[model samples]
Structures are given as structure tokens and as C-alpha cells.
Target: MSKGRGKMKKDTNIRIGTRGSALALWQANYISKSLSKLGVKSEIIIIKTLGDKLTRGVLSQNRNRGKSFFVKEIEDALLNYEIDIAVHSLKDVPPDMPDGLILAAVAKREDPSDAYISRKGNFLDHEKRKSIIGTSSPRRIAQLKHFYPEFSFMTLRGNVETRIRKMHELKLDGIVLAYAGVKRLGRKEEITKKIPISVILPAAGQGAIAVECRKKDRKVISILKELNDRRTSIAVEVERRVLTKLEGGCQVPVGVLARWRQDTLLVSAVIASLDGKEYLKEKSVMNQNNWKKKCDDLAELLLNRGGRAILKSIRK
Candidate 1:
């Protein structure tokens, strides 16, 4: 048994499983440092996931791939007791977890906005007809279409640096990416524009880091609990519940943003078709005391308001 955080001491080091990507390593290191504050020691174990292996083409090109593409292998390692815990970008985690695994904690969130990066002048100054944006997210595609119907789009895939490098090499107009990723990679200056959440709701759990451990591993969970941010966890929970209720995955053209305002929780979500032809959005607020019910209500509201039809069309 290893020592937990704080005064609790264990004899062994906590093994953290993470994807080998730079961003993933950063997140894992962040967790390790956080644990160190409580006097716990940890080691990062790099693991390759399907998402890491399929770097040849855009993820959107594969309709058969599931939401767990980036996380299944890591979860498997946790279940097999090969690692003590798994660190993941919450956006990559599916709403449902494998039977024995649980989301132990959600770290404090980063900037949740999406950013526009372009080698050309400012993206907004470019001519719409000539401007070609790059992104693989259907959510971004749909929302951007709603705002700038004249713009054309192409699939852009790769890590934060790779996308930026490809953008310059290909001399493409611009690419959309999560601002959190850019900031994590110390490339904040590359942002040409920060798309507001009002215009483009972020993906569920977009800016949060999640820690996963086996449900039976009480010691690991206890150590992780010290690093959990309560507000971030609640916000992401509401967002993910809406996603789960909608039966949407990370690849779905669904966007959700949730926040705490005063004593209330506000949730906004959107569901759209691949072509951006049909879109449904809903926003609701409720006292934090009824967060779970509010999440359900918000999902029901969206579903009743054409979201169901749009989701069905997307699945087909």
C-alpha cells in the first residue's frame, strides 16, 4: 500500500497512466505535482491509445470509431491493475465508464473557449468566399456555419503543435482548437481569435482534466479527492449528464457549456446535423440544490425542441 496525500503515507509510488501526447503528459505531470503537495509521490506511465495511433487521417472520417477511442486502453490498464490511476482530458472521456473504473476527480478548469489560429491575417478580416477553415469537430463546423455560412471548411487533425505546423506548411486559412490546449502547450500567442461560448458552446468537459481509478481502489480515490475541484466537477457533471441523456459521444455534433452563476447553475447546449442544416439549442438555470434535476430538465427541453430529430438524423 502506498501513502495517500497529506499525513497519510504509503510505501509505494502511485503509477499514473496517460496518453503519450505532449498535452497528455502535461496533464499527467500536473496531477503528479498536485499529489506531491500532499506528500505523495507518483510516476507517469505513457500509454498509446487508438486516437494516438490513428494520426494518419481526420477522426471525423471514421464514423465507426466510438467515443472511448482515446480512453479505452488507459481504462483497461486501470482495470487490470497495471496502473494506479489514469489521467485524461475530460473531453476525451465518454459519459459512461467501464464497470470497475470511476472518475475520481476533476481538476480546476482552464479557459473553456475555442480559439481560431490562422497564418493569414486575422481570420475575421479574410474574405469569406476565399477563407477555408480547418477543423475535424462537427460541433465547430455546425456552429461556425450558423455564424458564417459563407465560409468553407476542411478537416484538420493532429496535436496542438502539429495542427499549427500543418496550418503553416499547408498555408491554409485558419484552424479552430480548444483554447485550453493552446494555453497548456504555452502557445497562447498563436490565437487569432477566441470564439465566445455564446457563439460556440464548448464540448462537454472540454477544459477539465479528469482522474480515473478503479472503484475498488479506495486509497487512490482518497488521494485524488484532495485534488478535486468541487465547482468544476459539478459543472462538468451537468454538462456530461446532458450529453449522456442525448446519447451523444465526443464525436457527435453536440456542444454543451455549464457554469455556476451566483447560487444557480446555468447550462447551455446545442445539437446539430452534420451539414449544419438543422440545429437545436436550449438554456436553463436552476438553484444549485437541484442540479441533477436541472440537468435532466435541460436535456428534456432540448430533446423536445428538435434535438431528438437532429440527433436521429446525425446517427443515420
Candidate 2:
């Protein structure tokens, strides 16, 4: 570990737990660099998971799937004290953390928007059923089908780069990926179209990087806290609280976007059917003084109205 230059200067080896995928490595390395700026050196520990090994089809399409698809392995490492901190894509994390784990810090959120990588055309061309598209998210699949039902949908498997390659080699069409991942991987140029949240709502915490560490370790938590972004954390908390209230733990097709402006938080959530036919959308503003309460109440409203039915439908 390199020594820091000032008050943070300390000889420390921070183990950063992350998936072994290129996109995951890129995110972990970025966080490592940020920690170094605060005078703490970080070593990235690659994690392997069932989700990464299975590249046969859409993860959401698997009935036996768990929200831990991208999380379980690293969570185990944290539970066993094999790593000091774990960096994750907030969208893929289950609403509930392991009993002893903590979501201690979150990086500043990214675009929180979806990006489309079309081969040589646009979604409209596909809307005409002239092309086929591929993806792995139920949220995207549902919305895409709703908007462009005539186009064919297929399962997308593998890591970010591999999926990109798969789309090109199979010559199917384009893929829908989070803009944050594509940008972080430095492949922004590959994006043929960047979808805005106004049209395509993103998965909860879509573009944010979350850090999970053992709840009892204050030293590691303190070290990681130096990199937390206040505004991003607040907004994501709003979105996450909504997920918690709705009991959306990965199998559910839920989406949300939260923004903070003038000391107020505006959050929107959408619950949809697996086949992209039915949906219930809601948005609300939270007073700066009682953000959590507002977020919880709004989430409750959605769940009671039609969210429960949607959940039951997806389960079958």
C-alpha cells in the first residue's frame, strides 16, 4: 500500500471485494483510486458467482433465481471477513442485506439511465418487427415489449463485454445496458442510442455503486466513509426504501428514479408485469424534513393498489 500524503496518510491494505467481470473490475478499480486519493491503498479481490458462470439466458427468466445473483459470493466473503469492503451495482443487490452486513457507503450516482446499443438501426425499426433485441433485465424486457411489442426479445447472457460481443456476433440487434456500466467500462462509444429515464425508467439504484462491509467493523467503515457522496446516498436511500416497502427483492419488475433538488427529493416508481402488459406507476415528492416517511408512505400506496397483484402474477 502506498503511503498517503497528509492526515489520511497511513500504511493500510484495504481489500475491495468485487465480481471478476470487466465491468465489475472497472468499478472496483475506480473506487480504489478514490480511496487512494484519501490516503488509503486498496487491493481488489475478484469474486466468482453463479450469476457470472451462467451465461445461457436472461437471469430474470429463471424461476429459481435469487436476488443474490450478483451478490451472494461477495456477501459471503464479507461475512467470513475475507474482505474489508465490497463494491456492488446497487440495482442487483437484494432489498435485504445479510444479517451482519451493512450498506455503509454509496458513490455518487451516475446517469441512472439506460443506454441502447443498436447495431445499425433504432428501436423503431425493431418496433416494426424487422429486428430482434436482447437483454437480461425484466424491467427493460417488460418496458421494451410494452413499447415495441412487435419486435422479438431474446435472452442475453455473460458479462458486460461478452454480452456486447454476443449481440454483435449473433447479429440479433442491440442490447439494453445501464449507461453507468458502459461508461465506466469506457465503451460509451458503443452506445448507438442512450435512453432517457423519462421514457424508460431505470431499475432502482440503477447507476450507483454501493459499498457493503461488515456492520461491526468501524475501522473499515470509517475508511470507506471517506468516499461516500451525501446527495447520491440520500437519493438512493429514497429509492431503496421504496424497494423495501414494496418487497422487491429481484424477482419483481420494479423501477425507480430519485433526484434531489432544492433540498427536496422527488422519487418515482413503476411496477410492471413480466410480459409487459400491465403496469402501475407513481411519483411523489418528499419534504426535505421528512424524506424517509414520505418515501415509505408513497411505496405503501403502490403496494396496496396493484403491486401485490403484480407480485403474485410474476411469481407464477
- Cα lDDT computed for each candidate against the true fold: 0.85, 0.80
Q: State residue 172's C-alpha deviation in candidate 1, in Å.
A: 1.2
Residue pairs with backbone atoms closer than 3 Å in model 1 (clashes):
2-10, 3-9, 3-10
* lDDT per residue as tens, model 1, 171-256: 77899999999999899998988888877899999989999998878888988999999999988988899888888776788899
**What TM-score does candidate 1 get on C-alpha atoms?**
0.93
Query: lDDT by residue for model 2 over 194-313, one digit each (tens)?
Result: 886755788778899999988777787897788889889888888888888887755567788898878878888888887777877899988667888888888888888888898877
TM per candidate comes to 0.93, 0.91
Candidate 2 Cα errors over 4 Å, as ranges: 1-11, 55-58, 61-65, 123-127
Which stretches in model 1 have alpha-carbon errors above 4 Å?
1-9, 55-58, 61-64, 125-127
